[model samples]
Target: MTVTRFAPSPNGPLHLGHAWSAIVGHDRAKADGGEFLLRIEDIDGARSRADLADEFRRDLEWLRLDYREVAPQSQRVATYRDAADSLRAMGLLYPCRCTRAEIAAAATRMGPDGPVYPQTCLHRPIAPGPGVVWRLDVEQAADLCGQLTWTDERRGEQVARPELFGDVVLWRKDAPASYHLAATIDDAADGITCVTRGLDLFHATHIHRLLQALLGIEPPVWHHHALLVEADGRKLAKRRDAPALAERRLAGEDGRSVAAELRHGLLDTGISFADTLLLDA
Candidate 1:
């Protein structure tokens, strides 16, 4: 059976942008007679608000989205650690002690996800410890699994270029697992056949494709739908204080109507669909 998931971090309340993404995944699964899953990405440690997870459920309920809940990332530390250990054993991971400010100051050029890591810690021989992060040796990893590819439902086949991101983090010193490692493992664990998410993360799929190859897992077809953006063209984000869905619910707005509007590419004032191609089609 086809499976798709809406994995949201519980660090903040659900907004309209989040609702659109959830609806896309939920409706897609329903359309295909497949299963829809909801996974809480609460692995950000202290930054993750446990209470917000409950709010997320409430929001989804208000939106009338049906989904099966999966174990949150906090409950899957061992899984991530086991995966990290496997990669380490294969000599594909190394410990990095560089701080964010230090990396920004030292980085000479940028890549898809900001400044490419300069490999300062690649040859440092640093041992895994409390204060160090684990980074994938992207060069070595690509060599091991040469000429990898993944398919996007809309964009067709893509050549995986994991090296573009440099040695990306697999495990963080403050969190149990980085987004790349945890999300990839969770999708495979849940037997997800369709990876549905926003286009902002389109580039991250390159790294995900590489991880799938290294771990010997079957790759899923991707559907990177367009994002909902403000009139200024910036994407709606919690950090930017975007309007929350809870407010609309509290105002007694009809959730189903709102969802229907979103399906037709209509949204509130000052907010619009960034792109309509293949959205709820």
Candidate 2:
């Protein structure tokens, strides 16, 4: 059976963009008679608010999106550590002591996320410690996997290029697992057949595909939908203080109507869907 998930971080209240993404995943799963799962990605340590996960459930209920809840990332730290240990045993992970400032000073080009690491500690014998992060050796991992690929529901086949982001971090000093490692493992653990998320993470899929290959996990088809943006063209984000869905629910607005409007490409006064659903080929 097809399975899809809407994984949200409970660092803040849910917004319209989040609701749209959840609806897409929920509806897609229902359309195919599949299971819809909700995952709370609350592994950001002190930044994650425990109460917000309940709030997220209420918001999804208000929006009429039903899903089977999964174990939050905070509860799966041991799994992430075991996955990291496996990678380390394969000689695919190395400890990096470089700080963000040091990497910024040494990096010459930008990758999909930000300044690429310059491999300052790649060959250095850095030990795993409180201040060190674990990074995957992308070159070696990709070589072992060899010519990997994944498919997007809308974009067709994509050749995996994990090297685009250089050696991405698998484990962080502060968090139990970096997003790439935790997400890749969680999807496989949940038996998710279809990964539904926004377009902003489209590039991150390359790294995820590589992780799936290295971990001997079955890959899932991807559906990266369009993001909801503001009139200024900036994507809606919680950090930017995007309007919260809870506020709307408290204002006596009908949740089903709002969801229908989003499906029809109509949103609140200032919110608009991206020009195109599919990214440019």
User: What would the per-residue lDDT of candidate 1 be over residues 1-281, giving only the tens digit for each residue?
Assistant: 77999999988888999999999999988997999999999988787898889888888888888899999888889999999999999999999999988999999878777888999999897877889999999999999999998999988998988877899999998888899999999999989999999988888999999999999889999998989999998889999999899889999998888899999988889998775432111
Off by over 4 Å in 1: 276-281
lDDT of 2 by residue, 1-281 (tens): 88999999989989999999999999989997999999999999898998989889988888888799999888888999999999999999999999999998999988887899988899998777889999999999999999999999988999988878998999999888999999999999999999999988888999999999888998999998989999998899999999999999999999988888888988789887773533333
**Stretch of 10 with least lDDT, candidate 1:** 272-281
Query: What is the TM-score (0 to 1) of candidate 1?
Result: 0.96
Task: Give the lDDT of residue 233 in candidate 2.
Answer: 86
Clashing pairs in 2: none
Using Cα atoms with residue i matched to residue i, what is each candidate's TM-score against the true structure? 0.96, 0.97
Compare the candidates by TM-score and give the number of the best one: 2
